[model samples]
Target chain A: MSDSVLRWTRPLAALVVIFGLWQLAGRVWTFPGYLFTPGEIARAWFASLDPETGSAVLATTLRAVAGFLIATAVALPVATVAALVRPVERILEPYIGFFFALPKISLLPLLVVWLGYSDSARITMIAVSAFFPIFVYMFAGVRGINPGYLKVASNVGASRRERFLHVVLPAVAPMAMAGVRIGVAISLIVTFAAEVVGQSPNGLGRLIQDGFSALDYDQMYAGIVMFALIGLGLDMLLRLMTRRSPGLWGEGVPA
Target chain B: MTSPSHVMSTTTVQPTALRVEEVTRTFRRKGRNVQALAPVSLSIPSGQFLTIVGPSGCGKSTLLQIMGGFDTPSTGTVTTPAGPVTGPSRDIGMVFQRATLFPWWTVEKNVAWALRCGGTGRREALQRSRELLDLVGLGGFETAYPNELSGGMQQRAALARTLSLEPSVLLMDEPFGALDAQTRELMQEELIRIRQAAGTTIVFVTHDIREAVFLGDRIVALSGSPGSIALDLAPDLPRPHTHEVMRTQEFLDAYETVWACIRDQASAREPGRSERAAEQDDQGESA
Candidate 1:
């Protein structure tokens, strides 16, 4: 088979085989209490279609995406300006490094104490976790730009605004996007952790926590499956978006 | 200037296109001042194709940048007929050694953007870009991205982008320096043709002696570090140069003269090389 053809079919074939064996084993023997059969998990997943459960899924998605966007919006401009100005960079470095080194999840309890067990606190945790990677990548991207490009921009008499929009923005876009990809992944992880540990009213993480406490292994596995699907779906969508618009990521990277 | 295309009629009294008055550059590196260029002065007439040649680290690129107003000279001034240069203007365009085309843009859009900077509207900029692309022999590659093109073709696209501004004078810093030998020669020919069509005054900097001779009406050689003009020769080569002209005696003699000038500077600086190398090592350690 061609490489492109095998790329989809091979992994898919392994998944099918694995699931078939798992179902056979579960039916033949008594598995652990936490281990639910694939059939039972599917039934639980279908049962999760009620509005309350649907809102749990929605809560998780909103938290992750909003947090990622907020981090990106803040990081890109901050990094660009910081990299361009020496005094700003010097002032920002210590703060950036300190925050980046901190475990953002540890702040969730303190934030919950301050803001209550609310979306704001959870989203803040996710946003704080997402900021560091985005900022670092963008700062390096702006700094790594070829001085020659700026010289060319000046020689052509491009004004400051035009140069930023046309030269600096496009040049640093891929770096910013890479940072965003990582940021989104971090937001998803942080959102789940914050949701579960903070004991908020509703979220996929809360649904999983409820299932575990009730000894409803099927619902727990189904919630876990939903997270995996959401992750895969998001990654596929983002990759597709970047691939579709080659102009945004095309040509060569900044020197 | 129009009557004689070959351009050695100093008696014609063409108005000065660009004048450099005792310009020098000193860069501060590692808490020490490193003088890149000594006080250098030269006057170029309108529509003249002048080439500046020197060895590496000879500060030829620095001179070109100063002329283009991309860098300020430590002292002295550069003036065009319109005004004294405070910074880069639309009247003076530049092409760097590396093609600085926005990778996101296709060949045509790159040229169009330069035109758009001059306040040309969308349709007209695209139209002018098409013409410029064709002029640079990039007729069919308009929609192709910079990465898809070869080094020579990218440089051609860069040249087209700069030319779109309709600048009266163009400053190029080793524009062909990075290309392979064959591509470099071909680009040299392309530049000669483009200069003829546009009649734009040019100051082309290169380390290659033969390239300096083949494309220039006036060749100025700068010696090693703290470089100043070592020799200025105006070889009366035939106009509308072709590749075949490379075989002519006029071309060969001009080549030899520049080659000798550069060779002499190399040996003269040979004794000071070890001292410079030690200084560089000290700078590296400090850094």
Candidate 2:
């Protein structure tokens, strides 16, 4: 009980100290137009809570989640196929390295030209940005399964489908989940980036962009704060899910 | 340590459960052919406990893997009563050195998973797994994840999973080798009890001679550069084995015989083993 209390209190204390110091500093100095006190940011967030914040939150969430799901759907099967068939791995080898090294954000213009400055382009951009991390982790996960596991599967006379579903799926789940966590975070980042630079008309990215243009520092801070909160919420949700589920952990000995 | 039946699994007139005919294993490593095991032939009778003992470099584990059809012999065949061993089957279950229990699952789920592979329904399989867990002394640990359990408990869960298949033969490759001494001893006793209840033929592989003498009705010792059976003894030790049995004259004599055979192998160099090939064999993957 004490440990759990301490867990929250320590981080909360640190955050309070940082924010309090920032607020005090703002009061002592004549700040620039682009900067706002933490108090002013909170007031701005409350004022925009109804339509502005809600719509932006919804738009950003939809794009990020859709892109994350799409990326997972593609990366998982591709990784499995690569693990199962040696030739597929050989074929994907060069491209996996090349695409991983290349910055995915640079493809936004090409995507904009192909799909237009719409949600589709933004969603596609998020997925493209998220795919490499998911694929890299998932590929490593699938390839690194213990040979003993497959031996046990066959020894039990499991059919091909059963082996895939029971052994392969569960064995890769922990690592895949790790990939999904990173992918989800990447998805939100890409969504914000796509919205901001690509000049999307909606989303938290747009709110920040508009705030910057109007010299409303509080609004920009509010948008940034909301983005951070959403990221924290999603991460907490994923963590809660892993803890509740039994099999999505480090396989006893990484075997 | 004993449960009930097959306490002495008398060697004579018992039908053969597993027959390995002149089996040899050769591994091709970096364009060089490495012979892991020389010709090995053994006939294991039904419901008997057969332990294969050897030094670390010996192909005891390789031989056990072949018995389970996890690996194929380079030059021979392993036959069971059903047919020649061509592939892994539920009839021949295997328990590995590492517990290898799926970390994502509870103990019950891990055991039920094996039954599920054999087309059992989920609820029924889970109920049956409870019974198997009870048999392995994990009665209340059904909902516990593998990681939550100790090394011994994990092995118990693993054994329960293997037993869920109701295999005719159990091929164990150093299942208790990773456990501490006390846990290893405890598992050994539990294994004897479990084997009695299960009444399946078991081919357990380990490098411990004392373990072999304690557990097996028949013991096969493999040692030296390339693996071959150095000693095969059927000791008439006390049944319903306990630690006290280890102090018996019969047990001591059997242990002495097997130890002598292995000691001689290490002391004297075998013929046709070039120093380079022997070094490669020592560092080879088979063990």
Candidate 3:
């Protein structure tokens, strides 16, 4: 076989073996209804493709994306300012560390109470959760720029704005993108978790909860599969964007 | 009697391009004051290439930084024809020991970015960048990234970027020090050519005596911990120097003089004879 074919064969074989074992176990053992067979789960996943579930998926995706955008818009400029000014960094350091250390889920009840039982509450939770990772990574990126680049800028008589645009932005973009990738995953997870815990009116998390209450095990499994797919799809989309514009990020492709 | 026009002609004078007036730099480290560069002074006329040579820890870099207005001297000033330099100005450009090109930019973009920062329009900057790349012998590699090029090529690109600013003075700190011996020699010749073409006053810092001799119109040898100029001599060499010029007796004598000065300074800092002997014995056993 060719090298390319051989490279893919091993992973394919392992997946096939695992599915076979799962089917065999389903036949041999008396498993709980909630513990679904792979075939049954696949069938349920296709069956859940109605207008209602599709809207639920859209609702959840929109919330996650909005929350991520909000976090980026707020955190990036704040982190840039903090990184540039020592006094601001000193003031924010302790509080930033404290909030980052605090479990984001623990604040979900307070957020719901403050913002009421609306989409705002869930978004607030997701935004707060996503903010720390992106902010910290961006701060580190700005601080970690090679000092020589700044020297070159100064020597060439680059103005303050020019230095920020040309030197600082390009240098920190790759690291900031790394943080954004993690933030995207975090935003999705926190949005879904907040939906389930807060009992929001619409979303995949609510659908899953409704399925459990209605004894629709298949529907719950389908909801989970959709969640995983959405996260994976968004991450891949981000990776593709980074690859397309290698100059902006400095690193050409994700490893 | 002389006419009024004759009097005006006689009175006209050109100001010095760069002047370092008794500059000194001291740093505070671990609650102790450390003198980095002692009082040193030099004047560079316009369109001259002056090279500064010294051993490690002699504060050559500190002095260069001071002259470039990146760092302020403790007790002296660096004056150009305009006035005393308070900070980094557009008229002076610096090239570091390593190529400080932005890795994200292609070779053409790197040079163009410097021009853009200096207030040139985008299209004109790019056109100028292409011309500079050709001048630096990197005509076809404009699209290549900094990491894609060899050390010599990267440094050449860096030189092109610095030149893009059209500065009156160029301050280079060991620009080709990281290259191989052959590449360094080639770069040295290329630099002389560029200097002649551009007619910018250059203050180049290096530890290599031959490099100092090859490129400099005047060579300044600095010595000691808190560095000061030990010797300042102009080598009597012909213009448009070549490899054959390096082989001549005059070049050898000048190289020997610089080498002896550095060697004597190194030995002067050595400990007593018994300690030196013991250190040599340890090295002998290790070898």
Candidate 4:
């Protein structure tokens, strides 16, 4: 536990320094009302977590989770099948590439038109945005498995399922986890963006939009600050989860 | 560059082990036929260690690949009384020049995977894998990933995995060809020890003459394109050949004999090659 804390000390210290500078600037420049120091943001952030306002954060978190889960469900099997079959890769890669090339924000209007200004549209956008990175990373990782390992497995009499369960999945997990980590950050960002564009009933993005409409700069800053915290928290959670996953890091010995 | 005599004397035939009759392979590359192996014939008695050594581009690997049933011979038959070699056989294990261990599996799991695939129960297979690891001097590394091991250790894990299948014949394509000198020597010794313990027939291929000589009961020296066996020489040496035997006159004499044939082939490939034709002429006359 101490070791893990040490590992994060530098980043935590940097966070402190940034907040300290922001607070100092607010006090020195007589910009207290507008600048809204770290203390003010902290107070506001905690207050925003009150049962009524907290529901919005909860709704946004659920949306992000649903979007990411859907993306994972779609991407993993597609990536695995694509990796195993050359023809599938040749057929699907161009279309996937085309989708990835498009500006995700450009699809916001179409998504709202199709799914309406509800949670569905926001979640759908998030899923679509996160899908490509996970797919591409996982596909490459699976396809890059050394043929020698397969031959060894085949020569030994491993059924196809056994080979997949014991070898292929494990080999691809680290690369896939990296993609998942990236996708998690992307999904959160896209969810926030979707909420802002679609004018969803509640979310950090919607909250920020509402503050902007009311000309409440401090509230807008507070929403942005919360957004950053949520993103950081999710990423740290993923890193911890990956570190614990089997076949992830060099945790146990070979046997 | 030199040949070491095969020191083992278990040459008793154990029926038809492996048979290759007029096996030919050709690859169609953009409308041209590249004959890799042309109408080759060979056989190995059960339990004999036959090493194939040849010049580059001689299709030594192509032949081995065919024998392992990775690719079909364009023509002819590879008949083993045990059964037909279709795809890959659980009875025939293989180790490549590169150790192809799954980087994700722990050393023990990798070995156990082989056994489990060969129909051993999970618990028993895993236990057997541990024993195999112990045999390979990796007893304590059962849970260690391939990435953590040195090249030699990774290859050892590969050997253990191959052995876990309890294969009748183990096909190795220059398994230690990628290692440094010391590691190569250690691996060669390790292979000999493992083979002795397991009693698996081995068909190992290499370009290194010394390795071919060191490991083989009979060394098949193959020559250039349209690869065919140029010489089939049995090494009549004492059992359990050690490094000490490598320094003896008998070893030097055997090395010289093999090198003469290999060097002769090497020179013959070059244009304006000066002959040992005169030497052959004199030797022929003396004979």
Judged by DockQ cut-offs, is candidate 1 incorrect, acceptable, medium or high?
medium
Could you give candidate 3's per-residue lDDT for residues B165-229 as a string of tens digits?
87878999899989999999899999877776776778999988889988888899988567889
DockQ of each: 0.63, 0.59, 0.43, 0.37
**Candidate 4 stretches greater than 4 Å from native:** A1-8, A14-40, A249-255, B1-12, B29-32, B267-287
TM-score of each: 0.90, 0.91, 0.87, 0.87
- Per-residue lDDT tens digits for candidate 4, residues A120-176, read 888899999999899988888788766666777678777879888877777677778
Global local distance difference test of model 1: 0.85
Model 2 agreement with the true structure over B201-228: per-residue lDDT tens digits: 8999988999999999899999744689
Q: Candidate 3 chain A: worst 10 consecutive residues by lDDT?
A: A246-255
The sequence of per-residue lDDT tens digits that candidate 1 reaches over residues B185-220 is 889999998888878889999878888888888999
- Between prediction 3 and prediction 4, the one with superior DockQ is 3
**Could you give candidate 1's fraction of true interface contacts?**
0.66
Worst 10 residues of 1 chain B by lDDT: B278-287
Candidate with better DockQ, 1 vs 2: 1
Runs in model 1 lying further than 4 Å from the true structure: A1-7, A10-44, A47-49, A240-244, B1-11, B270-287
RMSD of each: 3.6, 3.5, 6.5, 7.3
